[model samples]
Target chain A: MRVRVLYFGVLKELFACPSEDVEVETGCNVGALRKVFHGRMPHTAWKSMAIAVNQEYAGDEVLLHEGDEVALLPPVSGGAPGNVPWKKIILPSPRTV
Target chain B: MQIAIVREVIDAGSITAALKAGADGAVCVFDGIVRDNTRGRRTLYLDYEAYEEMALNQMRNLAEEAIAKFGVRDIAVVHRLGRLYVGESSVLIAVASAHRGAAFEACRWLIDTLKKTVPIWKKEQFEDGAVWADGEPFPEEIVRG
Candidate 1:
């Protein structure tokens, strides 16, 4: 079976090329897919990353299906205001002691 | 005025065209680009997947709210759905207002709300591997207040 894993934000830097399809073995779960990705980039901290299956957030235990559009999202730098579009607000840092 | 998740990269010209006759005193455009690196790894590109219907609806809702709450004149929010290369425009936001302050406030409000309410997820493709963003989870309560 094949799964199309999508990359965005800072996570794209993990691959030589962004946004391509990946071929996985049959009966592979989300965790298994992460293992394959980990093999490609041994330095990646997969545990901190998030996964979404078919546009919905999924856990590592979720099973993968053929043609599943999976995505890997990193921690967003900004906050979600809920009533408006997302914005990045930068504040001044305090002086070091 | 329009909200969509398009496969092609955002067209700046289209955005400008959309806001032409809206009695806008000020127009603000924001372009979100793909950075070259994440953490310690080098990136090749980025891919964005969105719950199309929900995302569009949410974007519209955000726009409407900005107009009502902040008195925005017009707005256009377009985000790329498919693959995007480095430095390509992934997201474009244009907000127009009768005054500059309201326009800025509304634009900020629109983008800030879209991040939380809109069901769009972005994935990162690194040189070593790939990962999924902790995207919007569905089948849950959606509070619009």
Candidate 2:
């Protein structure tokens, strides 16, 4: 089986590409696929990364299928720190009042 | 709820105005912009990228969850990709609700959760060099062994 693997964030720099098609043995799960990359990069690099199958987060036990879109997601940093308040505030709900 | 991942600049004012409803008492907006500096280094620009399809999916899920969890009436989340100069709006999140509390809570929660879960990455181009910004660690449940 083959899967279209995607690299995001630093993984793109590490892998030197945005995406690629990888050949994996049939019935291989996400864990097995991760080991393939583990051989390339240091073990610490894999510690915080997450895998997404078909755009949804998947566990290691999740089996991969042919042509599945697997994404290597590094810790995400999306939003900017606006002037919004950082302190957690819990206001009384109108209903509760 | 309106959730989108756009390449063009995000228009925060218009999106916030569009989300307002007669029944809503408040609309909280979080407009995330590119800062001019990181630490002491001067930032030239920022290049943001994402797994588009997956990002959209994750954003939509967050919007829906915010509505249910915080009782926000509606939400519009738009994140821009490609190169963005300093002070440019990189992402916009607006939450509408009948009460101000819900709107405020939802708006904050949406941005916080999106930063952690969304498959978006930012590369900072400093005046001296360029590097990928370190991302916050993923939630434990999302990390695969």
Candidate 3:
């Protein structure tokens, strides 16, 4: 089966392309697919990437079919106002308490 | 009308206006801009990219969830794509409600949630080099399951 794999951010830079068609065995799972995907890119590229099939995050054992839109998502930096991550911080001791 | 992933500059005025309606006491607007520096590094610009289909799906879901959870009357989320210079806004959100508290809280939750789950990525270019910004890790539940 062939999967249309998409890349973004660091993954795109690592793979040197935005997307490509990947060939894999029929009945292959995402975990198995990772092996083939990683082989085509630099070693470090897969360290932090998460796999998404057709937009939803997929677990390692998720079965992949032909023509699936798979993406290699890198560590994201927050974009837009509604696109930021939250950080927990301990504040300096307060005076009013 | 409520969610958009655009390449053009974010129009805060229009977005804010879209959320305003009669009887709403306050409209809270949250804007995320491209600054001149990051961690003391001089930033030249930023490039944003997204898994458009997934991003839009996630964003609209978040907006609906915010309305249900926060009881906000209206909410708008807009994220910009492509190259952006310093001082430009990359994201903007507007929330309105009959009271101020829900709008403010919803705005905060919207940004926080979007950062973690929306499939958007940003690359920061600096004077010396460029790199992708490190985002928060996915929650254990999402990552493990």
Candidate 4:
């Protein structure tokens, strides 16, 4: 399977390219894909990065399908007003945008 | 107007009018201007970029959530990309509601959330050089290994 991977923000700077298509085994997971990225950049900067699949943040266990869109998001720096944690600020309805 | 990631110069005046409603008594606006300095560095310009598809999605989500939570009637968020010199408006958010409280709360919430959740990144260009600034960190739960 081939997954289209994207890099944004500082991750784009680290990857040296915005996007690329990577070959992965069928049903590979995000952690496995991270391993691929880790192999490419095994320095301290690659650590603690997040991954998003199909526009939603993904956990390691989430399985990847063919042609799936994956993104590497850098460490975000913004927060809710007055240091409010984002997890506590739940939306009343998670509507599809 | 409503929600946008534009490359053109943002017209704050038009956006302010766009958020106006007859029923609303208060309209709160937050204009995130690019200053001439950051941490003592003389910033010459700034460059913003976003994860286009995901950015729009998150922006809409933030607006809808604000309306539901703060009871605001209207919200307009416009962000600029590419190179912007100092004293330029990098992002603009306007919230309108029947009362001042909701409008104020929504405006504050919108910009903070937009900075954190939306996949937007900014690079600060100084007289010496440039550096990318990652907005505040995402929640620990969302931060994957």
Candidate 5:
């Protein structure tokens, strides 16, 4: 059973070869799939990325089935008005009243 | 009238085509463009991609939510896929309502909710490197940011 993996955003540039499809063995979990994908693109950062299966977010332990639509999503810096992940957290110093 | 995801660039006319003078008293539109910089990094371009089926469903859901929450009459949302250069439109959402207040609220909610719920993600290309725009897993942080 072959699972179809879709790459998007910056992940597409990771391949460096322009190949969109990745073939994996049946019953391989998301963690294993990440390994294979990272192996292909050694220079690209694969850690701490998000993966969605069949349009729903999935964990690394999720077992993938055949024909499952998997998409690789990297950290989105800014696109919409609200979402921003890497902002510096500022803490105020304590002052004697 | 319909929710669509196309590979071509988005335009204001396409999203506002469903609006009319008498029928639609207020026309609220949200046009998302590729910004020039992110976190002080100069951006070269943006690459947008989505889960076609689910994205359309999510957009439709936003329309319904707006109608119930803000009483918007007609809504049309079109998101672009593929590469978009600087200053190019990437997402277009228009809401037609009987009143201006509802139209404004509905439009704002639609775009805000769409960012959280939609499966679309954008990759920002910069001179030094590129990064996915807020692609984290946690919804709380992403929503607050």
Candidate 6:
């Protein structure tokens, strides 16, 4: 079987490409596929990366089928830091009566 | 709910205005902009990228979850891709509800959750060099061994 694997964030820079097609065993799962890259790329890079099959997060147990769109997601940093006000209000301590 | 991943500049004011309803008492908006600096380094610009389809899916899920969990009346999440100069709106999130509390909570929750879960990445271009911004780790459930 073959899957279309996508690279995002630093993975794209590391892989030197945005996406590619990879050949895997018929019954291969996400873990097995990850190992294939781990063998070639720096092991540390794969440490925080997650897998997405057909645009949804997939666990290692999830089976892959041919033509599946797999994405390699590095940790995400999307929105900017929000200026949310402090949640807890500080009150004066009660004086001894 | 309105969810989208667009490459063009995001119009924050219009989107927030569009999410308002007669029954809603408040509409909270979070407009994420490209800052001119990162950790004291002068930033030239930022280039954001995403697994487009997956990002859209994740954002849509967050919007839906915010409505159900926070009981907000409506939501709109829009993220921009490609190069963005300093002060440009990179993302926008707006939430509407009958009261201010839920609106604020939902808006905050949506942006916070989206930062951790969404498949979007930002590359900061500094005056001296460029580097990918370190991302917050995914939630434990989303990571696979």
Candidate 2 wrong stretches, greater than 4 Å: A81-97
**Any runs in candidate 3 off by more than 4 Å, and if so which?**
A38-44, A80-97
Task: In candidate 5, list every pair of residues with a backbone clash.
Answer: A75-B132, A75-B135, A76-B132, A76-B133, A76-B134, A76-B135, A77-B132, A77-B133, A77-B134, A82-B145
The A-chain TM-scores of all the candidates are: 0.69, 0.77, 0.73, 0.73, 0.67, 0.78
lDDT of 4 by residue, B1-145 (tens): 3998888888989889877979999989898877777656576766778778888888888999999999889999888887787777778899989999999989988887777678777666656555666456676777766
Model 4 per-residue lDDT tens digits across residues A71-93: 98765532111232212112233
Of the two candidates 4 and 5, the one with more favorable DockQ, higher being better, is 4
Candidate 5: C-alpha lDDT: 0.67
Q: What lDDT does each candidate get?
A: 0.63, 0.83, 0.78, 0.76, 0.67, 0.83
Compared with the true structure, what per-residue lDDT tens digits does model 1 show for residues B5-80? 7887578787867785657778877777776765545766666766465467667777888889988878888888
Task: For residues B1-145, write the lDDT of model 2, one tens digit per residue.
Answer: 8899888989898999999999999999999999888666687887899989989999999998999999878899999999899899999999999999999988888888998889888777765556666566789899858
Model 4 chain A worst lDDT window (10 residues): A80-89
Sliding window of 10 residues with minimal summed lDDT for model 5 chain B = B136-145
What is every candidate's C-alpha DockQ against the true complex, given to 2 decimals? 0.06, 0.29, 0.24, 0.22, 0.14, 0.26
- TM-score per model over all chains: 0.57, 0.90, 0.87, 0.86, 0.68, 0.91
lDDT by residue (tens digit), candidate 6, A11-35: 8877889999999999999988888
Tell me the docking grade of candidate 2: acceptable
Q: Which 10 consecutive positions of candidate 5 chain A have the poorest summed lDDT?
A: A88-97
| Number of the candidate with higher TM-score, 1 or 3 | 3
